[model samples]
Target chain A: MSDADFSLWVYLSRTPLLWLTVTLLAYVAADRLSAALGRHPLANPILIAVLLAAGMLAATGTPYRTYFEGAQFVHFLIGPATVALAVPLHRHRRTVWRAILPMGAALLAGSLAAMLSALLIARAFGMPETVLASLAPKSVTAGVAMGIAGSLGGDPALAAVLVILTGAIGAVTVTPLMNALRLRDYRARGFAAGLAAHGIGTARAFHVDFMAGTFAGIALALNALVSAVLAPVVLRALL
Target chain B: MRGLGGTILANLPRMIPGAALILLCQLAGEAIAHGTGWPLPGPVLGMMFLLLLLLGNDLLPEPLPTPSVTGAADGILANLSLLFIPAGVGIVGKLDVLAQYGLGLAVALVASTLIGLAVTALVFAGVARLVGRDGEAEDAA
Candidate 1:
């Protein structure tokens, strides 16, 4: 066989292609099982996907880069996807306008609280400054968080991981929290999920209701702005 | 012939701007980050910048000047999960970082999310009242 053929097998062996493929398939299977069990929030697709993928990587000894290479296609689209959120916000312009002042206040207060609380807790635990930077923007969407991390001198990779974990956890807890608080409005529930979790939580909210999705999209965008503004000033002081 | 040509011409101008708007925002966001030497990404700046533009231009009205923009946004968000594949793929390279830092990372994530939820809940509750929706009316609304 030619060097090319030899090289191909070598690359495949070193890479975690089989493990990731299995993980993705396992993720789909778990989702099917969860849906059959009646849409349990504990069985959330994001949560399942993450846990299963983590397990597979650990079991197979496949490196993360290899899986990422096979999976980066998903990452590339986050930018356009985020931009798309604008369409829904645009569609709800009237409602958005009617509640602009309230939404603005909520967005600002919620965002500041998210950042400050995360920073303080991480500090109390004696987490490194770099890790704190990554956590600083975790509440925002991944695309924005990654950018903010790079700008603020946080590890972008760590930020991306935090962003994913944040989304997954937020997606899982949103419904339970809403029910507990008696937040029945689809818009409020959705906005809260998306603002707290970003895209991952928004996806979960969308599965529950369209109004929730709309609110989540609005929350996602607004939080991105608030986090961007808050991360720098806050990090400067903390760092 | 005249109608066919006019149709394509009309769509061509509209479609180009819609596409360009997204690309421009992504690029501008990255550029601003680069220029300012801050941690902010270019696309984020693009988003905020777009919001400013929208506020100025009424760019987000229900009857957007063009349907293509809405369609474009829809197609992107619907399959947003697909975009994470690349980032997930990047995880392979960062396993070492993840391993060394996983616990701290997990703690930060859970903590921030709970904080985010509490803050959101409080803000909405407080704002609902301050705006005179009040607790009773808010529950009703």
Candidate 2:
């Protein structure tokens, strides 16, 4: 509250390194906490880290853009990380190849189910057209979902937010739901989570087991492709 | 030449080769996507490219010289969730939209995600049963 303290705060917030350091430190703390909690899906480190960072930003009155200037370094890793997914895909190639037909069928059915249910539920609640369009690709990863949302005349930024929320919701609820359904197969559980939740779900699958993670990665990539191609057409027909 | 190669490998970080391969694939993918006007993102295309490379390696009589990509990828994948936090934090800026349609959006997202997962899992399980090849068995093999 003092003048000197206020000036020091303003000076430190101006530099991008502060946000970058905060982001990493928050994640480290949250990751440790998640481990301490036995890696429960609901105690997801990313969810905790984001909340801590957002809280810090709000408290300091630092703009998202300013925070992003430093945080984008971490964001840039997503592309290469996605490419690295092929390592797992290659390791499990035989399993994936053997079920190519079933995987394709699942992709089609799951994509349609995701799009239709999202639209129908939103429409039932009388959501606007843009929100409906944005919601159409909510199951896909953020980057692809935003692109699809833009093409479908929706808000790309909103689509990104929705994609993250969808992923978080999927990650949190999937394991319990799978257990209740008695889906004991890791491959089946991973594929279903990936198809429904994309990257975050895949991350959760990886935490569960390596085999599950591999299938989840494959499902994430294939579902994105299928949804990208089919969502616009489905939206056209429905709208 | 073999001695030199060994020396370099010993000195270099273990993650470099895998990271380099992934970045190389991403760059190639970006170039191809941009040049060909593809609808897919560069990273997705890069994944396919890597897949093909792996398949090609399988066809060769000799094993590829590169270090284990899986090992390298494991390092990154372990912290994969952390990479998404920055973007998730951006949601703070969209408080108005969330405030307006928060209930509807929440209902739609949760319901649709659950339905999608259930449908996908059931279909996958049914198909796996028909095929008579348990994924766990294959995984063990």
Candidate 3:
């Protein structure tokens, strides 16, 4: 490459703006493609965007840390975005309140099942204890899952990865599986999606329907509480 | 389109205070959770705090910044999926673990997530039916 081109590359790579722009552009492209495909479950915008961004980083030989310096701005929003969920929850308070009994029951059952199933499966496969701990809270959102995993003597980063994967799997499967079960109750569908997949599933729920989205947010919030307390307790019982 | 864009731009300034309120709630939540050794995450607590304000907004003499926060929040939540991409990309860097335990990890994640979803969904549906809320949920839907 020419010196001028190389110099330009060096400057752009170091700037946070470049990767930040790439993250947005990649999401735009993915969203466009997903929309084109009628927002099919498999055409998940996140899976597409992450792959696109990761591919560009690898192709350009950019370090993940350097890329994150720019992308972290976007990542930081997960916190406020979470807090913003209260808006919808408040708006749909009546619906949420009406479903309170079901929500409580589902939250306990789902939280326990989600944590226990992963730990049991991982153990049967002979995964290490630390890895099991990391896998236990995979259903919680990334930030909370990371903390829960860390407290349980697991690798937080590993927990984060598992959480994302679990979300994607749940997001993709929720619609088809719910349809097959003939479940027309958006509340039940959304509650399950959020309970099992956290934010990613909640994101998918929002796309499918509004009521579903609100219930998903409620489930997400409640599950974070349940899983945090439950993960350590469940781990102790199993170990 | 142009008019909507202009409106969004005009309303952008008002969003700041509302956004700040959200951040403040999150900050207070963080302090409480960390200080008191709570198991809950700060943002989740912040969510509950915001809900309380919303519920009691009528009781306040001047009213809280509900409209502005709604605008800010809707904007944030609408584009929520975009926020996950950065951390999602971190996956590429963590490929070694994926490489070594691909099968087990794959099975564990998929199986657990699906089982959890099905169990929770069925339990909710079944319990809601018994509680007579399933019909209401359907009618509401």
The parts of candidate 3 lying over 4 Å away from their true place are B1-10, B60-65, B136-141
Error of 3 at A219 (Å): 0.6
Ranked by TM-score from best down, the candidates are 3, 2, 1
lDDT by residue for model 3 (B16-103), tens: 9889989988998888999999998998998889888888995788875577889888878777778878878888888998888888
Per-residue error for A199 in candidate 3, Å, reads 1.1
Q: What are the per-residue Cα lDDT tens digits for candidate 1 across A1-239?
A: 79999787667756556545655575566566666767677776656566666666666676676666655545666776776666676666666665556567768777877788778777876787777877889888887898788777788887887787778788778888778877655655676788888888887777787667877888887788778888889888876
What is each candidate's fraction of native interface contacts (fnat)? 0.41, 0.69, 0.77
Worst 10 residues of 3 chain A by lDDT: A90-99
RMSD in Å for all candidates: 6.6, 4.4, 2.0
For model 1, state the Cα shift of residue A223 in Å: 1.7
Which of the two, 2 or 3, has more lDDT?
3
Going through the candidates in order, their DockQ values are: 0.29, 0.61, 0.73
Docking class of 1: acceptable
**Model 2 per-residue lDDT tens digits across residues B1-141:** 235345545645875877888888989988997798766777888888988888898889996865656556666676788788888898989899999999998999999999999988888887877877755736434
Scoring only the A-chain of each prediction against the true A-chain gives TM-scores of 0.87, 0.95, 0.97
Question: Interface RMSD (Å) of model 1?
Answer: 4.0
Model 1 C-alpha lDDT versus the unseen true structure: 0.69
Q: lDDT tens digits, residues A35-55, model 2?
A: 899989899887899999999
lDDT by residue for model 3 (A140-237), tens: 88888889999999998788888888888999999999999888888999999999988889989999988888889889889988999998999999
